[model samples]
Structure formats: C-alpha cells, structure tokens
Target: MKHDEFIRRVSERAHVSAEQADTLGRAVLQTLAERITGGEADDLAAQLPPELQEPLRRPRKAPADPFGLDEFLRRVGERAGVDGELALRGTRAVLHTLRDTLPHKEFEDMVSQLPTEYRELLRVDHDEFVQKVARRAHVSVDQAQTLTRAVLQALAERISGGAAQDLAAQLPPELREPLQRPRDAHAEPIGLEEMLSRVGEGAGVDEDLARRAFRAVLLTVRDAVPRKEFEHVLGQLPKEVAKLL
Candidate 1:
C-alpha cells in the first residue's frame, strides 16, 4: 500500500494517531535493522516500501551487538519516544505484519539470523494471528476474518495500480482476491474516516471497531511492499491523507 495509507492503517491498529504511527513504524524498523546483520538487513530492505527502506540501509553508528528481547524493546522504545511496553506492542504489530507479507522461507531466513528470543517476537501462527486481532479489536474470530478481508480490499484501492497488482501476486490465494479487487482509478481520494466507514460496512461492524481492524491490516501492508512504490502511492493521495504517512 501507499505510505500514507500504510501509516493511516498502522495508526488505526496501534490505536495511535497517524503521526505517532509514523514515529513508531520508523523506530521499530530502524532498531530492527541495527539488531540484525548488514547482509540480512539488506535482504529484508529489498522487500520494503521506499519510505521504510532507508531505515535498514543507513550505516549503523556501532557494530551490531548480540542482545535479548528486553534490550531490543528498550532500544526501540527509546528511539520511538515511547515507553518500553508501547514499543514492544508496536514492534509486534510491525513484525506480525511482516510475517504475513513475506513468503514463508524468506520470512524464515530473516528470522533465522536473529537471536533465539527474537524468534518468538517475530514468529506468529495463523491461530495466533486471528486471536491477537480478535483480542485487540474486541471482535470474534469470524468478525476478525471479515475485517481482515475488508481492510486488504481497502488497501488495494489506495496502492498504485501496478503496485497493487504486484502485491496481489505476492499474497497467498486466499488473500489475492482482496488485493486484486477492481477499483476506480480516477475516483477522488478519501480520508481515513471514509476508509474506516467502508471497512465498517464490509465487516459488519461499527466504525470504532473497524478502525482497529483497518490498522491491523494496514501496518502489515506498509512493510510488505516496495518502498519506492509506496512513496509513489503516498504522493498520489490528498494532503490530508498524506499527513498520516
């Protein structure tokens, strides 16, 4: 998805404003880059959106050092200007999204390079994915699935046409439909509120709950697409929408 759309989605999921999502997303991604080997970081960077890739590419001030999950959360929290708890939540949100977007082996290889504790932080199963969203959104598993489908469809609309198609290609068959759904190319851009409304309508939930679900899916899409294409997607959005990214 586009950068603005991606941030807006994360903001909804993380229960933060767009600006806060931007801050948290960058912090989590940058800190993650520092924790892993340069080659591994580069490999992961190759798969991220343009606005997010730089965090993984910039030279680290110090060599990567071995660290546990607590230290990882502390560093990310410090950089994100949030407490450790909030940082940990944001990191999980980002990582879980990564798990969904990447191919299984690609995701596994990146996780393999990390310390053992890192594995638990990054790894997620299908049941866990559904359960986490259900808990956070206060919705049933069935509702969460509906929400997930709606959010992915909405995201496909915001991403550029070519990028959207590429994203569909990457997703599993179960997810490809939402990403490949047809949308009007010349339609006027809508703000987060409208997006949430559509998600609510599609998921058979209220706007408040839909917002939560929207964020959950959007955060993942942000890290899933190529950064350059994501930047282009951001540029095409309205100013109000762009501010969110």
Candidate 2:
C-alpha cells in the first residue's frame, strides 16, 4: 500500500484523523522495531513505503527488547501521545495492515519473534489458512483442502502421537481431524521422498503438485502453531523430512 493510503486505512480503522493516524503508525512501527530483531525490522522496512520505513530503520546489531502486550501498548500510547484504548486500536490497525500487505513469510518471521499473546492478535482462521495455502501452491481451494489433509495425515504417521496432538491443538478443529487418526506403534520414520509420494497418492496429485502443496501446508502450519510446537514437530522428523518444512 502507498504511504497515504496506508495512513488513510489506519485512520479509518482507528477512527482517528490522518495526522493522528500518522503518529500512531510511526509509534506502532517504532515499538515493533524494539520488539523484534533489528535484522527483521530492516527487512520489514524494505517492504514498507519509504515514508513509513523510517520508524523501522534501526541499528543492524540492536538487540530486541523483551516485552509483552501490556508493555507494548504502554510504549505505543506514550510515543503517540494517545490514551490506552486509542493506542490499542491504532496498533491493531497498523499490524493488521502489515499482515495484509507483507508477504506471508516476512510477516510470519516477525510474528515468530513475539510471544503467544502477539500470535493470538494475528490468528489465522480455517478459511484463511486454506486460502493462504491455495494461493501459495497455485491450487484451487478444494485441491488445497484435499492436499492439506493428505499432508497432515502423512505427517501424523511420521511423528510421535504426542507431537501430532500438540500440532493438532494449534490447528482449527476442522483441520485437526486428520491428525487425530490412530497411528501404528511401530511405524517407521518416513523420508522426504516417501512423504511426497504418499501425499501425491493420497491427494491424487502429480509429484510436482504434491511437493508444492506439501511445502505450502507445512509453511502455513508453521505460521499457525506456536514456534516451539512447530519446532517440536520438526524435532521428530528425520533431517531430510525436517528440512522440507
């Protein structure tokens, strides 16, 4: 989005004047710069309009300040000279806009730096998740749905029951069903190639399509689950399989 349009959206969403919206947008970006790694902030700034990028430009080696939501809002409110409620509204407006505008991986990288509270602020619903995968994989929604279930079912078989359950907990209830299926106690670890084959056979797609869908599903799953939970899932897989994620 253009700088002016971005400001307009924030103003509209927060019910503030354009001047106030500009202040709030800068405040939120500055606070976010503090919260995330300097490198990520730089990358984020690159995608934003030049006028809006100033707040996100920081020292290359600056360490992130460890802060939660309360502290985050406190800093935003103080920096923007707004009340707590307006600060909260403005922060949501800015971040929600960022989510819509940034690439999935770039936004996911920023979200990964925050805690569970921040993740909840940008939670993806089932439809959104499917839509994201479909867009990423260049497939239809129905194809994405079938491919998602196939990938999850194959993943469930490969990982330990506990790990699968943990991952399933983070997914929507509809997506959770595939991960809920019974697993063989002695099932062998599946390699990356085998996984692609299984997903291709199960989803009735070609190998290339399966590979693309598998990556799309895993990347989206990484965004949906907590960083630690996603890491736990990775830990269960062979290095080859884990690298695919």
Candidate 3:
C-alpha cells in the first residue's frame, strides 16, 4: 500500500490522530523501504534518537524465523507462476482458513484455481496440495482447504497483483472485525530449521548447500528406544527395539 493508505489504515484503528498516524506510517515505511532497497538498517538506526539506535547497534539478532511472510509469499508466488497479487490472495485465504478452522473442500478449490505453474510447488494433486499448506499453517487439512477456497472467493472481488488490501477487504465479516481493530499481539513466524528437524530427513532438498553441517547434526539420534520413552529413560539406549512390522 502507499504511504497514505497505510496511515489511513493504522489511524482508523488506533488512538493516533490522522497526522500522527501518517507520521508513524512514514517512519515505518521509511524503515522498511530502506531495508528492502539496499540501505543499511544501521543507517536508519543511526537516524533514530539514541534510545532506538542503541538496540540497532548490537550484533543482528537472527529472527526467530527466516521463512517469514514476505519471503514465503515471494517464493510460493514464484513457484505458482501467479502474480504476487493472486498468490497473496491465496496466502491470505490459507491463513484465514487455518485461523478460523474451516474444512477441506474450501482449500482444494482454492489451490486448484491457481495457475498450472504451481504444479512443481505443491508436488501433489490438488487435494494433497491444499492439505499440505493447511498442515504447515497449523490447522486440520479440511479446515485449511475450506478457508483457502473461501479466500479465493473473497479475493475475486479485491485482488489485483498480490497486495493484501483488496484481499483484506474481502475477508469474511468476522475476520474484518479483527482486521479493523487488530489485537495487540505479535505475529511470530515458524522457522525453517525447526521444521526440518521435525521431518528428520530431506536436508538437501528444502534448503541450500551451505546448511549441510547443521542438518547433519540435526539428523543425529542415537539408539532406537521408543521415542515416547526417551525422557523417562533419561535418554538411555533401550535393550529392545519395538517393531510392529
């Protein structure tokens, strides 16, 4: 969104007057734009008053997550071969579906509507593909699918090129309320390494060559004790391997 739209949105929801919101929005935009367009984040920090600048000087703290919304949408958009606008619409739908806890049909239709270029991205027929995005976003497969479909329907009205506003407007009435008066909460993202650690393999595929050493250590687990029993054994190796097969 442009500076004015951003200010308008924030001011509508906050105690800040329009002028104050505009100032705040400009500060935030300037901060973000500089970061995006090859300026040092430290330079922005330097521009800030001392209190804010102090925090910026320390070693850059790694974000708890690197696969953030901006990056995820960018990659997924590229793979899907849809413009960022449509991909964003799909993503918003995905996120909404997971949040409200919807059903599978919703997600399947949403995924199917995207351009065929996304085939490599999903690596599954439409049904499985929809389910996967839902699962990653932390909701039932059915719930994810349904919301995704709903998102597409909603986006039909507002989306153009991957920006969130038009899609944001189309959000379900229930969701609109929250968007209008956003809750005071942090939107923490899931990390890439954390997910690989959970899957236990495919270290090379999801990421680049530089992470091999980290993945190797992450893959190690000694002894085939019942994973359920690991903590009880104080991590001791069990004498028996329980094999149902």
Best by lDDT, which number? 2
Model 3 segments more than 4 A misplaced: 1-4, 39-245
Candidate 3 lDDT over 1-245, as tens digits, reads 23354444445433356665444433332323222212233433444344334323423432222234456556545544555665554444322322123233333333333344422332223444344445444556655444444333222222222222322343333333212312332222323344333222322222332133222211111111112222232222122211100
lDDT over C-alpha atoms for residue 178 of model 3: 18
**C-alpha displacement of 115 in model 1, angstroms?**
2.3
Candidate 1 local lDDT, 1-245, one digit each (tens): 45676676567656788888888888887887888777777777777678878888845344565777898899888898899778877887777666655664566677766776664554344455555567667778887778878977776676666656666654445666877744444433677787878888887888778877876654444444444444565565455544543
**Candidate 2 residue 116 C-alpha distance from true site, Å:** 3.5
Candidate 2's TM-score reads: 0.69
Per-candidate clash tally: 6, 0, 11
TM-score of each: 0.49, 0.69, 0.19
Model 2 agreement with the true structure over 1-245: per-residue lDDT tens digits: 89999999788778899999999999999999999989999999999999999999999788899999999999999999998999888998888678767886788789878887876656557987898799989999988999999999988888877678778888988899888744444335778889889999999999999999989998888767766788788787778756665
Worst 10 residues of 2 by lDDT: 181-190
- The candidate with the higher TM-score, 1 or 3, is 1
- The alpha-carbon deviation from the true structure for residue 158 of candidate 1, after best TM-score superposition, in angstroms, is 41
Q: Is candidate 2 or candidate 3 better by TM-score?
A: 2
